[model samples]
Target: MIEARRLHILRAVADHGTVTSAAAALYLTPSAVSQQLSALEQETGHRLVERSARGVRLTPAGEILLSHTHVVLAQLERAEAELAAYSSGASGTVTVTSFATGIGLVVAPALAVLADTAAGIRVRVRDAEGDASLPMVLDRQTDIAVAVEYRGAPGADDPRLTRVPLYAEPFDAVLPLAHPLAAAPRVPLSDLSGDTWIGPFPGNPCHDVVVLACEHAGFQPTLEHLSDDFRAVVALASAGVGVALVPRSALRGMDLTDVVVRPVDGIAPTRRVFAAVRCGAEEHPLIRPVLDALGKVAG
Candidate 1:
């Protein structure tokens, strides 16, 4: 019989393209991962991995096994979910992961709601970006992830996870109070073509959103300052450093004293936030209440 844990390790290796990366994702050491892979090969009587100077590649048999691994893992999750539903009250902890602003905007508020209503349930939160959260959910490190949609994110129907839509928020142009465009009811991104921009660092999803929006507006933004913190990005704009485009939700509760935020006139760039769970665990007793609370807060 093939051990599900070894199959999980194989899937991780395939997903990340390296045993070392898979180990990191699984919170195991490289040697441990290698040992598990070797054991799995002995059990299956198949060569599943090809090692080269560059890295490891999956053999055709490995690819086939990986496909089955996904289905088996999801089914196991379903069995666990069903068993949890039968066992007792929804009275355990649920681990959640989200980006920084999402913690403030959605997850925190949902925690309050859950505390008032489902006091038996507790939540532990981790601050992670969209890129990291989905994998965490798949690995069962997080029960649910409040993640944003980025270019490479899995689609809504991905078999490995289930995505529940929370909100779609637009990016607002933030300008210094003294800037001429600050007074406009709506700012065209093209109008800021010549202005210096403050934005998130490259490789961040928000950074890509801003860059793609600017490219659509006919010019690449001159990014003079980069920060992952939306609050810092807005603060920099307030200090007359440069203009910025920040998600509307991120601006909540911030003191915009010297900043002017206006909607973009055309093709407003927006980020879609959602909750993701392992494919078959969306309705797990402990997870369902939290997902409901988050949906309520998002609404």
Candidate 2:
């Protein structure tokens, strides 16, 4: 019989498209991954992969096995979830991943509540961005991921995962105290058409949001400064270098001495944050309580 663990390794390899990448995802060495793949081939009596200079390609046999692998793994996940539900108490560790601001706004508070109420459940947290967090959950790297609605994120009805809506937060304009619009009750995105913008790097989800927001307002921002850290973005605005738009949660516990924040007047740019878990494991006893805690905190 083929081992379930070997099938898992194969699925990882197939998903990642390289032995090295699969090994990194599984926290194993490439040599270990190769050995497991070899063992799996021997057990199945089929040449599963064709290795080439570029990368390994799945053979017909490998493709056939991969189809079965998904079903087997999902069934196993369902079995584990059911078993956990029937267990006397929720006493296992639940790993979670979230972006920086969500960590402060949601995960941290949820963790605090879990510690006080569900003492038996141990929680491990990893800081990952929205783009990476949901994939981490799909890869079984984390039990839950706090993610945001970003360009290229998986849809809400993605079959492999279950998404739970958390919060919808608007991005506020940050400007220097000395700026002309600093005292305005609200700032329009078009008003900053000529202002030098400080924003996240181009590929970042937040950067995409800012760009889309600006496009909707009929102008493209002249991004003079790039930063992933929202606090630093606000600080740059305060220094009179450039203006920025930052999420509300990012300002928590920050000192905004010379920076003024105001909502956008017409089209408010907002991000929706949510939680994702493996589709079949959402009802796991330990996971359910953590989800509850997160919902309470978000509420």
Candidate 3:
């Protein structure tokens, strides 16, 4: 069966005339968008697109599929609009799971907004890591999960859940105050290649983030000390043992006494945070308001 999500991707390519442009509009990598288009072609057993030096154009098969894609997407939107109206007066609880920083940064403030403006909605917040929270949403343990992009996260086209992007935060380099480059306005990640590293353990999501960041800087980090808690990581750096890459959000609660924070030179590694709900629940009246509130504060 053809996935509706792929149809949307097809429509994006058709409208934009190139894979790169479509990927940008969809907030996806160009490679990911191409993979989806390829899967779409395989499912239909026809070549859907013709790529050339200038850009891309649809083949006859692609044209036919795109024509129907419009009708299908329109119907889906209509269905969502009607459902929104049906649940217009909805009043109930929205249970949410998020990491500690997420709870402090967005969730709690959003709850305050709901108390005043969305009296019909009541939100219950729980502290859960992003990896654990995603499964909780799938198992129906929570209505929503504030999650970070991770190694095994559900793809954008996953049918069981709806992904709403929240924001992306960068990882900053933390070094001992007495380190040679500690006072530099922005530290090159590669500059710390020779330094011992302090970071989260292997299974933690932050661990993958740190590893990826270091790899992007052209070298692997030598994790001399390990701690998942950002505070502990910073404390280790402050103790002048090693350096670490900590997310900007996690650093908010740190005591920074003998440590210096610097942005990574060139591009910093970033993690994308998003909200996930069971498929079709995003439009629910009560849940929609909370998502809106979250967006407002996340801004």
Candidate 4:
């Protein structure tokens, strides 16, 4: 069988245009390179190189073999490089799952940074809402997941997840521009008492927070609209549909032309942003970099 080392010698000779230069590049003696080339010729039953006083050149068969060798060697080099990067936590495909707003505001930018900084890393992101993203990490279906929860919300105790704090985005009042309370420097929960409320879709942590905030402020929230998407809620608020309580991060990209965001006067409802991976796989090569990226974006 033809050895790759012998092939290497032939390839090197062709690359350097001479056996002496090939030997110099390999840090091997010219005699050693000559022996390998001779052995390769015997193995292939063809003349691979013609040596002259000046140097050497490939014959017709040698040129064809060299063309094929170029592809094979390049592939092998790439495989080695990819394996090294995978081992070093520098590169690999990272499967990430995140909620809608988080993807647009946070994960997408972080991934863009990762693409620019880290080579051979391919990120595949799935847009899964809230706790739904947790299962992707827990089931090992994703390398990392960004999930959100209000302080007292259920399902924060997943033993299979190794959670990292990303951020705690404070909730703010989103009011229509024409509303009396919209001009306030800080809108109190009491200010929204009679206003129709735009709440998150039922069962979402943000939805519960909005309702509980209203009730704590001495009134039962009159939910005039329900939207899981913060942007949609903002759009509705801008259109005078209703006021909403939303996390600041979720509102970052929304155009508030007909709407205004103000700090809630009394109680500040915040949603905890967490980066989670499968518990035991905390040592995963691709996990830390993504987590680091998320942390950077959060900050």
lDDT of 2 by residue, 1-299 (tens): 99999998998788778999889988999999999999999999999998887778899999999888867877787889888777755897999999988988889999899989899999999998888887688678899999888887878766557788999999999999999998999998999999999999976788888999999999999999999998889889989999999988788788998899999998789989999988777788899899999999998
Q: Between the candidate structures 2 and 4, which one is better when assessed by TM-score? A: 2
Which lDDT tens digits does candidate 3 get at residues 1-299? Answer: 89989988887787668899878767789999999999999999999999999889999999899888856765674576467668675677889999887888899998998888898888999998888788677545688899888887777887557888888999999999999998899999888999999998886777889898889889999998998778889988999999999989989967897899999899888878999886666777767888888888888
Measured against the true structure, the TM-scores of the candidates, in listed sequence, are 0.94, 0.85, 0.70, 0.64
Q: After superposition, how far is residue 95 of candidate 4 from its true place, in Å?
A: 0.9
Off by over 4 Å in 1: none
Q: Return whichever of 1 and 2 wins on lDDT.
A: 1
The 10-residue segment of model 3 with minimum total lDDT is: 73-82
Q: Pairs clashing in candidate 3?
A: none
The C-alpha lDDT values of all candidates are 0.91, 0.89, 0.85, 0.76
Residues 1-299 of candidate 4: C-alpha lDDT, one tens digit per residue: 87867766786687568888778767789999988888888889999888789899999989888777745654554465456556785666888898877887789999878877665678899987665666455334577888877534335464335678887877899988898987789988977788898988776767767777788888987898987877788999989988889988777756877888999997687777788875545445465677778888888
RMSD of each: 1.6, 2.8, 10.0, 20.0
Residue-level lDDT tens digits of model 1 in 168-222: 9999999999999888999999999999999998867888899999999999999
**What clash pairs does model 4 have?**
none
Best by TM-score: 1
Q: What is the model-wide C-alpha lDDT for candidate 2?
A: 0.89
